[model samples]
Target: MEYTVVENSGYDREKDVFSHTSYWEAFSYRARHYTDSEIREMHVEIAIDLPDGTRTYEI
Candidate 1:
């Protein structure tokens, strides 16, 4: 399975960023950099590639 993660701050100070990987690296990256409150304020999406199709989730 492959995962693509996107983080959008919707602000000038932080630009939108994305990462594609076969593991949880993308999610982990966000955990390392942003605090819980900061993450809640941002728009975050996680897309997973499965055998049937792609499924996306937003937070």
Candidate 2:
């Protein structure tokens, strides 16, 4: 999914500067139709300027 910077959040100096970034989100759904044990994995990534350097991981 693409997310445009609504505004500059100064909390993150670097990332806040840039007004846009690329992001990816992945997930698994419909386990009943597929495999429950397989589980669903999601990958979300975005590119932008931020104090933290535009990198985050959430599982």
Candidate 3:
């Protein structure tokens, strides 16, 4: 399955602004699923910071 991080945040130091980068929740239904390692890599891929030990539902 493909991996996607729905909940996205952006920080604009020049403007000091942050907002939702995606319209879907990180763990919402109908959204793409991601592995633990992928989640960690995603933090850098998406340039969004995720809290330590983030987890997603699989059912």
Query: Judged by TM-score, which candidate is best?
Result: 1
RMSD of each: 4.9, 12.5, 11.3
What is the C-alpha lDDT profile of model 3 across 1-59, one tens digit per residue?
23233322232322212223352442442224555665464431222333463433231
lDDT of 2 by residue, 1-59 (tens): 22323122233342322223343211121222234342222111223334555533321
What digit string (tens of lDDT, one per residue) describes model 1 on residues 1-59?
A: 55655566343554435556544687887777778887777755555656587554532
Query: How big is the positional error of residue 36 in model 2, measured in Å on the Cα after superposition?
Result: 9.8
Which scores better on TM-score, 1 or 2? Answer: 1
Score candidate 3 by TM-score against the native: 0.25
Model 2 has an lDDT value of 0.28
TM-score for model 1?
0.52
TM-score of each: 0.52, 0.15, 0.25
- For candidate 1, what is the lDDT? 0.60
